[model samples]
Every structure is written in C-alpha cells, then in structure tokens.
Target: MSASSQSEPRLLFISGSSREKSFNKKLAKLGENIADANGIKGTFADLGDYPMPIYNGDIEVNDGPPDNARKLKALMEVHTGIFIASPEYNASFSPLLKNAIDWVSHIKDGGLQVYRTRVFALGAASPGGMGGLRGLAQLRLVLENGLNALVLPDQFVVPKAMEAFDDNGHLKNKENQETFKAVIQKLARAAHVLHG
Candidate 1:
C-alpha cells in the first residue's frame, strides 16, 4: 500500500453478536458506511473468527494469547478508533463481546492498560424496548477505564431491531439512522483531534 493509504485512520468494527442474523452486526455495518462516507476507513472484526475460551488469567499464562487475540491486538494498534456494536445479553453487554475485550486487553505486558489512550464508540440494538441502552451504559464505563479515550455521549440504540432493517440489510429506522450518523461524525472528529 502507498504511504498515504498506510497512514489513513482505520476504524475497527466489533460485532457483539455471533448469530448469523444479528441486529448489532447490521448496525455495525451502518456505522462502517457512515465512517466510509466521512472518509474514515472501517473494517469489521468478526468475533466468531476468533474463538478463544472465556478469559482466565491461569489459562492465558499457560497457553499465552490465542492466535486470534494476537491478531486483534495488532489491528487495534493500527486503528484510529474502535466502533463496538453490542447486543444486550439479559441486561448487560454480551459475554462474547466482554471476552473479546478481555483478550485484547490482556496483551501489552499482559495488562489491559495497553488500550489506554485509544478512541472508541459504543452502539447497541435489540428487540426490546430499551434497545440495549443498559448494556451500552455499562460498556461505556468499562471502555472509559480500559481504553482511556473519549466516547461520544450520543449513542445509537436500535429498538425492535428485527424490524429496523430492510430486506437488503440496511437500517430502515430514521431515528437510528440519524443517531448512527451523528455518532460516527463525533468519533471521526475525536480521532482527528487525537491523531493531530
């Protein structure tokens, strides 16, 4: 790749759901489109592609980071921002998402402090009325402590997510579409400021 391409900020999109037809995945894609439209390069990181057992310090020390964990950390090092589309499991962030974060955080001298100073944004979708709002709230707290980055206050939550998408997999809800745009704009702006 050219030097310019190499220097462009890469946005990593992490989908919390592993289901084939996950609404959070759809929302993540929407966020990616918004980022691309705003001249930000976005790439999706599939959790299923990296299946590590639930995080345990003993297991990590015994086997070191799984290949997937190493690959994810490498991507995080190059990316300018992380856009997480989480699904509410029960009433909080999904275990899969938490596990991914746990693995990524464990790298860098085997501590989560490596994520400090990174930029991140959170979004969630669900069939429930709250639209995974509770989950996003908790996620913000974790990201704040772990990533040490500014997360946009305006978050996107798609209620009744199954009905929020069209046959082509594009988000159909107007309010959510606007919220997604705003969130991406804020992330891009923050990333630019931090990058400079």
Candidate 2:
C-alpha cells in the first residue's frame, strides 16, 4: 500500500508489546497495510519509541510528564480512530500498554478529550490457542470504562501468531488477511461516523 499523503492522519494503530519480534506488532502492521489499501491513512504508533518511566504520582508531580509521554499524547490527539494490537500478559494486556494509556489519559484534560469521542478497535496476537483473547477483554474494559471511550464489539484474535505471519510480516493465510482487512475497515467506518 502507498503512503497516506493526508496532512493529518485519521486513524492510528499500535501494538502493545515492546519485544523485538513481537507478534502483536506484526498484527498491527497488517492493520496498517489494510487501512492504506482502503484509502485510509493509518499511523503506526510504536510504544518503544515513546518510552517513559512507569507511572508514579511522585515522579509526575515532581517532573511533570516525561517527554515521550507528552509526545505520544500529542500524537494520539490527532487521530479520530484507534486500533490496538495487544499481547497477553498473564490474563491481561501488557503493563507497557497500560502505562501508556495512563499517561495519555492524563493529557486528555490538557486539550480536547482524546478518549471521549474517538472510536476504538482492539485485536490480539498470541502463540497460544486463545490468541490473547482474554487480554482483549480487559483492554476493552479499560478503554470503555476507564477512559470513557467507544469501542467496537467485534475484535480479532490471531491464534498461533508465531506461525501466522511471513518473514515480511504479512499474514500468510488468505482468510486471515481478509479478516484483518475487515477489522481496519470497521475502525475507519466507525471513526467517520463518530468523528467525521
């Protein structure tokens, strides 16, 4: 898919893990490709590039938000749609992702509430049979209840994600690819309906 030339991107995708070969990141790449193919501008938000210390009230009070947190929060506000590809940690999503959410939520009152009206979608990729499906539920609760956001009911969970993608990170199975494309479409349409 070609690059989106829009001055401001309408949608953003992020993988919740920071691992080098994170399966969730591979899944998020599929969402990006699908969005661009469908003429939707998708921005891939890398948590690794936006590193900050774990949230501590003392630190936040002393130093204010870290530079990376501020940068990430800024990026988040520009998008009307959000799609998250998360990896399961224990029975929930990653602490890295949770912290990022906390940081961004703090910035909501600083400007237009980022999570209030935007549309959100979720997915997960795992090597296990459940494919991180359990974590997606918790993630959904945090987005909808904790942040007061709107989330789509349908979600994708790619089991055996270790074997799901090729070397170039594209889903090798034709059906899986199509489903991922559908997820992107749903997010884009929801964003248009809510934020257009």
Candidate number with greatest TM-score: 2
Score each candidate by Cα lDDT. 0.78, 0.83
Query: Model 2: how far is 149 from its true place, Å?
Result: 0.6
Q: What is the model-wide C-alpha lDDT for candidate 1?
A: 0.78
| Candidate 2 CA-lDDT value | 0.83
Number of backbone collisions per candidate: 0, 0
Q: What TM-score does candidate 1 reach?
A: 0.89
Q: lDDT per residue, candidate 2, 1-196, as tens digits?
A: 1112234338888999988889998888778878888899888887999998899988888888788887876777677788999999998999999998897777535523777767889999999999999999999999988888899998998999878888877888989788878878888887776677
lDDT of each residue in 51-147, candidate 1, tens digit only: 9889988988988877888877776666667788999887789999888888888776634643664578888989998899999988998888655
Query: Where is model 2 more than 4 Å wrong at Cα?
Result: 1-9
